[model samples]
Target: MSHLVLLSGWGCDARIWQSLDGHWPTGVAVSAPDWPGYGARPPLDEPGDLAALAEAMSAALPTDAVWVGWSLGGLLAGALLDHLPAPRALVMLGMGPRFCHPQGVTEAELAAFRGAFRRDADATRAHFLRWQLGGEPAPRTAHRRLLDLLGRESPAATATLATGLDWLASLDVSRVLADPPCPVWRLAGEHDPLLAPEERARADIRLAEAGHCPMLSRPEAVAATLADIAQRPEHSLLEATP
Candidate 1:
C-alpha cells in the first residue's frame, strides 16, 4: 500500500494537518512528523546542516511514501531528495525552488527578520504567523484557523527558528527539481502572495480561490485534491503540464 507523508512549513508542527482530519482518503497510511527541533522533536546536533537534518528526518519518513511538503517544508523536502533515498513522489506545495527572490522577500528583508527572531523568537513567530495569511479571502478568519491548528506547540528554539530562516534565505532546489530522482509535482494556491511568478507559470496544479494557506482555508478541497493525486500512477503525472 502507498503511504502519505505530510510535511508542515516552518513555525508549524504536525497539527498543521488538523484540517484534513477525517478527510484523508481511506487506506493510505499517514505520517506527519515535525522537523528536528520543532514542536517536541529534539534538535539535531547540527540543525543547520541540510545533510544532517535530512538524515535525522529520514528515519521517521517512509521512503516509498508520496511526500507532500507545504511552503518552507516543501522547499526543504526538495533539498532532501539529494540526501534521502528517492521518495515515491514529491509534491511541492505553495513554494518554489527559492523563497528569497523578486517574487518573494528580498535577502535583506529576510536577514532583518532573522535578526528580529534572534531578539524575540516568540514575538517574531506570532508576527510571522499573522503575515503568511495575507492571501486568504478572509485574512482574519484564515489566521484564526491557522492558530487553532497550530495549537499550543511552542515554536522551535530561537536558534532553530533562525536556522530555518537561513535555509529559506539561501537554499535553492532548482537543480534537483530540474531532474528529480522520482516524479515531482508542484502545486500552488491561486492567490498565494508568496509564490514566485516563475513558479506560478510552471505549477502543475493551481488550487482556485485559494491562498498561501489553502489547506487551512480549503481543507476539504485540499484533501480531495490529494486523494485524486494519490490515484495517479506512482511514477507519472498528467500529459498536460500546467
Candidate 2:
C-alpha cells in the first residue's frame, strides 16, 4: 500500500484533514504530519526555521512517500522533495511561487500580523479565516475550534514564522516543473487572494471557489483529487535528466 504524507499550512493543525478522512483512494494510507508548534507537536527552538524543521519532520515518514501540502506546507514539500529517500508527488493548494512581495514586505504588514497575534487575538483569527476561506466564512462551531488552536500557539513562534516569509519571496516552481519527473498537481480557488488564480494556472491546476482552504470547504472534491493521484503510477523514474 502507498503512503500519503500530508503537510499542513502554517498555523493550521492536522485537523485540517479531519473532514476528508476515509475518503482517500484505495491502497493508500494517509498520515498528516504535525507542523512545529501546531497540531499536538512540541514547538521547536527559536532558530529552527522551516527548512531545519522540515528536515527533522521528514525523519518520521517512511522513504518514498507522496507529499500533499497547502500554503507553507507546499513550500516545504517542494523543498524537501529531492532530499527524501523515496518517490514523491506534490499537490499544492492556495500557495503561489512566491509569498512575499517582490520588493519585500513593509514594516506595516509584518507589525500588523505580530500585533494581531498578541493584542487582538480575535482579529487575528478573523483575518486568518477571511484569508483561508475567501470570506466564505467557516461555521461558528468550526471557527471556535480554530480559535482554540490559535490560542495554543506561541506568539513568538508564530511571529518568527511570519518573519520567515522572506525565504519564499522569490521562489517559483516554473524551473522545477519545466521537466518534472514526478507527478505534480496544483489546486487553487478562483477567489483565493493568497495565491492568485493566474499563478496557479501556470501548473496543472483545478479551480474551485473555496478560497485558500478548499480542503475544508470542498472536502469531497479534494478527496477525489487525492484518490486520483494515488492511483497514478510512480513517475520518479521518468525525471532522469536527458
Candidate 3:
C-alpha cells in the first residue's frame, strides 16, 4: 500500500484531511500531520521553527511516499522536497511558490492581514476563518469547528510560525517546474483570496470549487485528486526517473 502523507497549512491541524477517506484510493493509507503548534499536539519548546520541524519530519517519513500540502504546508513541501528519497508528488493547495513578491507574495494587503494576528488573537482567529473561506460568510458554526482545532494552540506558537513564514515567502518554484524533481500538482480554489489562479500557472493546477480552505469546504474533490495521483504510474515515474 502506498503511503500518502498530507500536510496542513499554518495554524491548521490534521483534521483538515480526516474527512477525506471516501475520496482516497482504497489501497492507499493516509496520514496527515498537525503543524508544530496546532491541534492537540504539544507546542515546540523555544523556537525550533519550521526548518528544524521539517528536518524532523524528513527523518520520520517512509522510503516511498507522496506529499500533499496546503498553503504554508505547500511552501514547506517545496523547500524540503529534496530531503527525502521517496517518490515525492506534491499537491499544493491555495498556496503560491513564494509568500512574498518577486519570489512570492507579500502584498501590502496581505502583510496588513498578517499583522492583525499579532494585535488581537481572538479577532485574528476569526479573521483567519473568514479569510480561509475567501471572505465568505463563515458563520459561528463554521468557526466552532475551526476553533475546536485551533483552541489548543498557543499564541506564541502562532506568532513564531508567522515569523517563520518569511522563509516560505522567499522561495522560487519556477526552477522546480523547469526540472521538477517530482511530479508536482497545484490545487487552488477559484475563490481563494490568498492564491489566485493567475499566480499558479506553472504546475498542473486544478481549480476546485471553494475558497482557501478547500480541504474543509470541498474535501471530496481534494481527496479524489489525491487518489488519482496515488494510483497513476506517471506520477510515480516523475519522482523516480533519472
Candidate 4:
C-alpha cells in the first residue's frame, strides 16, 4: 500500500484535508503535515526561500509516500524533487509549471495582492478566501466550510504569507516537469480560476464543476481519483510533462 501525503495550499493548514481522511481507500496510510508558519509548525529559519522551505517539509514527510499537492503546495512538491528521496508518485492539482500565467494571476497582480496583505492581513485574507471560492459550483457552502476550518486552525504568519507570494511571483518548475524523478500525475478542477482551460486539458483527471479547492467542493471525487491512481499499474503511471 502506498503512503499518501496531502499538502494544502497557501493560507491553509493540514485541517484542509480533514474531509479526505475517511474518503481514501482503507489500508492506505495518509498524512497531511502543515507547512511552516501554518498550524502548529514554526516559521522557517530562512523565510522566503523555496529551497529552505522544501527542505523543512522534506524532513517531516515519510521517506516513501505519494505526494499530492494543491496550488502553492503543488509548487513546493515540485521543488522537493531534488531535495528528498523519490516518492512513489507525485500529483499536482490546480497548478501548472508556473504560478503566474497569462490566463492565471500575473506577477503584478500577485505583488499587488502581497501589498494588500501587508497593509491589512485580516481583510486581505478574507478577500483572498472569498476570491478563491468565487469559481466554485457552491460558492456559499464552500466558503462557509473553509472559513470554519480557518477558524479552528492557526492562521499562517504575515511573513510566511509574504514569502509564499514571493515564491509564486518567481518560482517555475517547467524544467523539473521535463524530467521528474518519479511518476507524476496532474489533476485539475474544470472551473478552476487559477488554471486556464488549455492547462486543465493537460490534466490526467478533471473534476467537473469544481474550482481550485476540489478537495473542499469535491472531496469524494478527489479521494476516488487518488485511490484509482494508487491502484493503477506502475507502468501505466508515467511522469507528466509541461
Candidate 5:
C-alpha cells in the first residue's frame, strides 16, 4: 500500500485536508502534516528560510511516500526533491515550478500583502481568504467551508505568514523539473486564477469548473485522481521512453 502525504498551502493548516481525507481510497494510508506555525505545529527556528523549512519538514516525513502538495506546499515539495529519502512520486496542485507568473501573483502584489499582514494579520488573512475563493464556481459556499475548517485551528503565527510571503516573492524550482527523483504529476483547476494559461496547460489532469482549492470544491475528484496515481506502477514514467 502506498502512503500518501498531503501538504496544504500557506495560510492553511492540516485541517484543509479534511475533505480529501474522508474520500481517499479505503486501502490507502494518508498523512497530512501541518506546516510550522500553522495549527498546533511550532514555528521553525529560521522562519523565513525555505530551504531550512523544507529540511525541517523532511525530517518528519515518512521515508517513502507519494508527496502531494497544493500551492505553496507544492513549491516546498519540489524543494524537498533532494532533501527527503526519495519520494515514491511527486504531485503538484494549482501551482507550477515557480509561484510568480505573468498571470498569477506578482512581486508587487506580494509586497502589498506583506505590508497588509504586517499591519493587521487578521484583516489580511480575511482578505486573502476572500481573494482565494473568488475564482471558485460557488464562491460563497467555498468561502464558508474554508472559514469553517480554519476556525478549528489557531491562527498561524505572524512570523510564519511573513516567511510564506517571502517564499512567494523569491522561490523558484523550475530547474527541478528537468530530472525529478520520481514520476511527477500535475493537477490544476481549469479556472484557477493563480495559474496562468501556460501553467494550466502543463497539468496532467485538470478539474472542470474548479478553482485553486479543488480539494474543497471537488474533493471526490481529487481523491479519485490521487488513488489512480497511487496505483500506477512505480517509476512507470522513467521506464517509458519519451
Candidate 6:
C-alpha cells in the first residue's frame, strides 16, 4: 500500500494540511500527525535538534511511507533520511534546503524576525501566517482557510517557536538535494515571496496561482502532484540506460 505522512511547517500544526483531507487518490493512505509541542504532544526540551526530533518521530512514523514535508517541515523531512530508516522517498512543497535566500527570507530578515518573536511571539507568528499567504491568487480566501484550520489545532509554545526559528536559521540542505539518498521531488510556488526553490526544480514543479501555502490555496493540485510522484518508480529503469 502507498502511504504518505505529511509534515507541517513552523508556526502551524499538522492541521495546516487540513484542506487536503479526502483529496488523495483511492488506495493511498495518508496521515498528518503533530510534531512535538504542536498538538497533544508536549514541547521537547530541545526542539532545535532536528536529528533528535526525527529520531523521536521514528517511533510513531513508519519508515516505509513516503514523507511529504512543507516549508520548515520539508527541511526536517530531508534530515530524516540520515537519522531514521529512509522513507520510500521525500517530497518537498514550497520549500528548499536554504530558507534564507535573497528571493525568500534573507539572513537579516530572519534575524529581525527572531528579535520580533522574542519580544512578542504571538504578534510575530500572526504576522508571519498572514505574510506567507500574500502571494496566493486569492490571498484573503487562503488566509481565511488557514485561520480556520489553525483554530482547531493547539498553538506551539513560544519556546518551541524560538527553537523552530533557530532550525530555520541553521538548516541548509544543499548537499542532500544535490545527491539525495532517495528519489526526491521538489515543488515551489511561482509567486512565493518567501523561499522559492524554482531554479532547483523543474518548471512544471512550480504550482500556478499559489504561494508559500499552496496546500491551502491549491489543495487539489497539490494532492494530484503528490499522488503522481508517489506512484512513480523509486529507481526508474530509464535512468540505467547510458
Clashes of 1: 0
Which candidate number has the best TM-score?
4
| lDDT (0 to 1) per candidate | 0.81, 0.61, 0.63, 0.81, 0.81, 0.79
Range of the 10 consecutive residues with the lowest summed lDDT in candidate 2:
233-242
Instruction: Report the C-alpha lDDT of model 4 over 1-242, residue by residue, as the tens digit.
Output: 76788898887888888867578887677788988888778999888766777678876666577788899899888887877787778899888888887777877788799889889887887787778877789998998888776673337888888888877878788888888888889999998887877888988888998999888899999998887776666676663433
Q: Give the winner by TM-score: 1 or 4.
A: 4
TM-score attained by model 1: 0.93
Candidate 1 global lDDT: 0.81
- The sequence of per-residue lDDT tens digits that candidate 1 reaches over residues 129-165 is 8788887888899888877777644557877877888
RMSD versus native structure for model 1: 1.9
| Per-structure clash totals for the candidates | 0, 1, 5, 0, 0, 0
Once superposed on the true structure, which residue ranges of model 1 sit more than 4 Å away at CA? 238-242
Candidate 5 lDDT, 97-179, residue by residue in tens: 88887777776777888888889887888888778776789988998898888873436887888888778777787777777
Query: Which 10 successive residues of model 1 have the least lDDT summed?
Result: 233-242
RMSD to the hidden true structure, all candidates = 1.9, 4.5, 3.8, 1.7, 2.1, 2.7
Indicate whether candidate 2 or candidate 5 has the larger TM-score: 5
Q: Lowest-scoring 10 consecutive residues by lDDT in candidate 3?
A: 134-143
Q: What is the TM-score of each candidate against the true structure?
A: 0.93, 0.74, 0.79, 0.93, 0.92, 0.91
Instruction: Name every residue pair that clashes in candidate 1.
Output: none
lDDT of 3 by residue, 132-203 (tens): 665223534445656664564443355555654454545666565556677777777666666644764444
